[model samples]
Target: MIAVVQRVNSSWVEVDGKIVGKIGKGINILLGVVKGDTEEDIEKLLKKVPFLRIFEDDKGKMNLSLIDIKGEALVISQFTLAGNVKKGRRPSFDDAEEPERARELYEKFVKKLSEYVPVQTGIFAAHMKVFIENDGPVTFIINSKEL
Candidate 1:
């Protein structure tokens, strides 16, 4: 599992012109589930994301966390994060988990995140247009394999 988390002023996901999920003053998480990912991966992320100090503190230092600010989270399934472009021009997704398993894990991830803060999600396996207003342009990439 991998997560590309971005601090955002606001974010939204639209599918077929219908808005499915939206949030304000939160983090926009583009998450990916690769082959071999499991519950432990999801569990760890829930604890990590909310506690990550990406927001600013009173002194303008990056010390505040999402939980500290009571912000929301917008998570989107993004298998492409695991795409390998080292070989051919066309990226290979062989490292990505199967769609069914990815969907299940993604939903579990969202459930776990919801425990810490208000969580929103994009439609699974659907074509979504995501609008993200990045805050401080703060972004972090995390991989479950690291742990």
Candidate 2:
């Protein structure tokens, strides 16, 4: 499992011109599930994401966490994050998990993350237009294997 986590002033996801999920003053997560990802991968992210001290505090230092700031989360399933471009000009998604399994893990991650903060999600497997108003443009790439 891999996540591109961005601190955002606001973010939303639109599918076919209809907004499906939105959030305010929080993190926008683009999540990818690879072939070998399991519940344990979700566990690793759960332990890091909510507690990540990427948000700034009154002192202007990056000291507050999502939980500390009482922020929301917009989780989006982004299978293309698994794309590999190391070999040729074309990107390969051979590492992406099957759709069904990816959806399962994606939902599980959303449900678990919601325990720490309010959470919204984009429709799994849908073509989405994600609009992100990044806060300070702070972003992090989290890999479950690395954690």
Candidate 3:
């Protein structure tokens, strides 16, 4: 499992020109499940994301967390995070999990995130148009395989 976490003033996802999921001031999480990822991977990332101290504090320093600020979350399934581009001009998705397993883990990830904060989500395996108003432009790439 891997995640691209972004602090956002707001964000939303649209599918087939219809608004699907959206959030207010909070984090927008783009999550990916690789071939061997499990529930443990999702559990780790769920704990890490909201507790990340990317929000500013009293002195305007990045100190407060989403948990401290009581923010929402928008979760989107994005398997391309595992895209292997080193081999050739075209990226390979052989590292990505099969769609069936990916959807299961994706839902598990969403459920885990919802445990920490209010959560909204994009449709699994759907073509989505995502709009993110990145605050602090703060982004972090987290991989379960790394830790």
Top candidate on TM-score is 2
User: What lDDT, from 0 to 1, does candidate 1 have?
Assistant: 0.93
What tens digits encode model 3's per-residue C-alpha lDDT throughout 5-123?
Answer: 99999999999999999999999999989999999898788778889999999999999899899999999999999899998799999999999999999998888778889999999
Best candidate (score: lDDT): 2
Model 3's alpha-carbon lDDT is 0.92
- TM-scores for every predicted model: 0.98, 0.99, 0.97
TM-score of structure candidate 3 = 0.97
Question: What local lDDT does model 2 show for residue 50?
Answer: 96
What is the per-residue lDDT of model 1 for residues 94-136, given as tens digits with 9 covering 90 to 100? 9999999999999988887898899999999899999999998
* TM-score between candidate 2 and the true structure: 0.99
Full ranking by TM-score: 2, 1, 3
